[model samples]
Target: MPDAMKILLFLLTICLGSIIMQPSVAQTVVNKPSAATADTVTVRGRVTDAQTKQGLPGVTVLVKGTALGVSTDTNGFYKLVVPSIRAVLTFNSVGYATVERKLDAKATGARVVNVALHPDTKALQEVVVTGGSPSQALMGSVSGVQSQAAHDRKQKRGGVSVQIQGISSMPRAPWYGRSESYATIQENSFHTARKEPLSTFSIDVDAASYSNVRRFLNDGQRPPRDAVRIEEMINYFTYDYPQPAANEPFSVTTELATCPWNPKHQLLQVGLQGKKVETSNLPAANLVFLVDVSGSMSGPDRLPLVQSALRLLVKVLRPQDRVSLVVYAGAAGVVLEPTPGTRRADILDAIDRLQAGGSTAGGEGLRLAYSTARKYFNKEGNNRVILATDGDFNVGEQSDAAMERLITEERESGVFLTVLGVGEGNLQDKKMELLADKGNGNYAYLDNLDEARRVLVRQFGGTLFTIAKDVKLQLEFNPARVQQYRLIGYENRALADEDFNNDRKDAGELGAGHTVTALYEIVPVGAPPVVDPLKYQANPAVAPASATADVMTVKLRYKEPQGSTSRLLERALRGTATPIVQASENLRFAAAVAQFGMLLRQSDYRGSATFETTAKLAEGARGKDAEGYRAEFVRLVKTAEAARRPTEDPESYGVR
Candidate 1:
């Protein structure tokens, strides 16, 4: 501005200019910090009920308008990281009104934001009482009504129990706006072995139906008839079956026992024990967690539970493995790139940052997840996409048929899919099941944290690593020894007899260390036939092999995870049948489960099967009870019995 010699006045002007310019530079620094220089603020707080002041677990705390969030722990404690102290946070939980808070802009370091949410009256009002005949209450509604009445009586009597009668016919109305969907399940009928000697179906390793049914029972509601898949129920529990010998992927065991339901018939238990693979020896994994953070998943049981379940899997991740997270809600995007499992904290941080609120673009999410998995495709390793959602796809490619096609096409790339279904009321069980089936994967329903542990931790190998795919089972009953037979379940898994040998056909995936079981009820030659003899044609002469003591032949087809051609396994079951009381624990436990399923389904063929008998059988057969799962099954049977209508005849409930 001036030559120093020119004037002191020139120097004064330069000094003023320097002061103004220096302040402007300082303001710029304060307003916008460089990306690398910016600091993340840590936020900690608790979420509690407004009225009760009790801590609320699974409350979703989020940085408003962003995907970053965290769910409160069991004691309602939560800690989150935000870009700045000025960030706005939102807290959401089921049955509670959403709450929002803005942080102090002038604050520094970590911040604290406690929230107390009030009950949402509108949500509570969704379930209202209405008058209807008990018969019109559907499978599970009567029990709910009776429970409510009993509660009212207890309250009136000052906690002193009093028998409430004449209220058996009362029915509670269903909650409004539920959209859960299940494919119809028609019970299998007896097939005259003389006419149809073969039974064919895809082996279903999925136990989603069993847990889903248990959810209903625990809620004091009878599961929907179509929701009870007997095969899934029987296979959910582990059996003491021998492991496969060398060069085999699984071992097949067969047991024949007097049918607990119909003593006149026999129960044949077919168990497949997949060869166990130690976790340390498993191939490196390339996994893409396709998480749904849609509006529907905002519920505590949905996204929150998903986070907890996935965390369990993460804990077992090895350094050689890699994980990527892709989330979808109105759109699809990858929150984390392919990160090595060694970066456990980074992966977990990414998971904790997830928040739910938007429409579901499930199809788009699948596309992105597969693309991610393929980009980091690990040859000679496990490549898979783990999808956790409520199966509610409302925004894009929403139909079950559309999802099935998309998953089917994506699976051809050798990236398997594992659908972890959570939440209820709007759970699209049919869609999830179809996706898993078509995607050459398995599905499990996480009803509680215990189930999450069982699926992701206790049975880690069986949950994530696939040893065999396209597994199908076919049984040829010896018409000479068996007059008629019916498969206990696998209604939807039925396959054309020819499909067993069709290498190109898709079937179920068998995970490492997984156990699959199937039950068959057989009417021996001397038993009364379920149907009159065919008048048009006489039965063909029994072959020499059929005349032997062999009751049936079991044939199984399977393909290696990476193989195109299938391998075969076969075994013949002898006709000797042991009394039900003397059956092995595996046989008796499995029979008990099948009997309970029949009773629940009210199957026409459930001869002499009673809840009391089911309980007794399960109680006696709960050997080794290492995990207490068998004992839990017995408890569930008792629960179902207690919930049954008082006036409903035991015979109608599967008792002879």
Candidate 2:
């Protein structure tokens, strides 16, 4: 064939082939999905209250139809990737009206989509109109809806009837129904020096109350009165008390000053400084992490924070230290066996793999942890179980009494416990305290990551190593000098005068380099007494002793952790009363904390103790705040002050 004819014939064949292949090519192009990244866009914004402009935390942000969703951070910030610009984003919270925002299809780079949610005011009215009490109506509505959904789901599946036992019957729990446990505290009344000359109590070194109080303040709520443990508040910050001398595990110092709240009264300050042992000289640690991976702990501030905190603690462990991990959720199991601290990666991997889902079996976890600790019991080492949980024990043996008995039994095995609480809503503070008190351990609430660092990193030595156990204090006040006196706090720690002499009684343990402070408000002979004079049983004050120039005598008893016998140390308070301005920085700061606690508790004894006064005292006495803990206390005080200001129109927290 000629070259022109061949080329024309080839072009015609190519055109026919192209026409035949066009349908397939078009079909392939149509079936192939576009790149997700090219179509989807990142939406970043914050959620806040419309009226107050305050960020609303724990708000759920989601795509209208997809399962993809995210909860807001503590700062009420969120980031979400959407399938398309036309997609609608929905934001919902417990007490706020639900909102939806449609993304602009034409928008290009990361779009900002901030939203202000209004309070759900109509919810209460709606519930009230349901022809029942507000609470009953609201709960009934929720239950009815959930029941209908379950019924529909059952009908869809061949009309088969099925019931899930032990599952939460309600689809959603009431927002306000979340409850925290706190022990009832009966404030101490004045004890006439003549009748009750000997004031005895166990020394409390736990600082859980301070961080717990800070949590309430941060959440814009006043903490419950029972949650305010004055002694813990005062001892949270490290004081500059002198360490123990030769042959002593701790040193006691005393100061007398005019009470900040009541000028007519005097304050007796007793401070104990535990001897600090070098980290190198400390005993090898055998630690078992009793972590709760329960469903309630499924939040950033709960299990995730616990993992981070444990990681920080792991970084400080030495080769001599050994760590084991035991997790409990519906049941207890050992995630990691006894492993050397050198194998940090293994421990971390175990921790990172932990997921939250199931009821908490805290009692079983404790039993397993104590058993694990005993299996590798370090005779000359720090054998301890660090229980990290939100304190929501819901499974077998969940009662506080049962847990107390279990802890007491395990404590006899010579294994100490460290209860590190995280999260809120269902925090069993009372149970935590009971376990720590009975199990020879200390309780601390880690409200945030910073607190975890503070407890696990900055104060590592004191947090893990106990130098002295069963430490008790007994004070004898001279009736001639102090007509009446009242202990500032330690309502739970207060012991009968005779209990101090009992060696078998369990008291608080003092960790290495830990500081304990106690305050006493004294009413002199001239000061007015809250109690009226007794007509029938008149107790006369003893004559002033001319020989001994002492107002009171303090006696402390403590046992070397391994020893069954306790050693006693006595000191007399004889110094002249110093004005608040002239008092030691430690005394001043502690007094400020006591006053601040009183204010928070709304105690009647908080005479002239305004938040301003507390702030001023704390600011002036924030000495050698190398870790800025005292500074943080000042900030918290300021926050509390702002929260306490009376408002005619209070902000509704949208609890339904």
Candidate 1 lDDT by residue in tens digits, 1-656: 65665798878899999887775776888888766237678899988767546566656676654435666765678898777666777776534567889988777888888998875422221211233322211111111111223334324433321111111222222212256888899888889887689999999999998998877665445776778889989889999999999899999999898888788888889999999999999999999999998888866567756876777688899999999999999999999999998898788667756778889999999999999999999889999999999988887788777887888899999999899999887988999999999998889998765577688887889988999999999999887788889998999999999889999999998999999999998888777767777678875644334334789999999999999999998999885789999999999999899989888888887788899999999989988765546755776787686553324443543333
**Stretches > 4 Å off in candidate 2:** 1-177, 539-548, 644-651
What does the lDDT read for residue 57 in candidate 1? Answer: 62
- Estimate, for each residue in 378-472, the C-alpha lDDT of model 2 and write its tens digit: 99999999999988998988888898889999999899999998877788899998989998989999865557767887677788899999999
Q: Relative to the unseen true structure, what is the C-alpha lDDT of residue 362 in candidate 2, on a scale of 0 to 100?
A: 84
Maximum-TM-score candidate: 2
Q: Provide the global lDDT of candidate 2 against the true structure.
A: 0.78
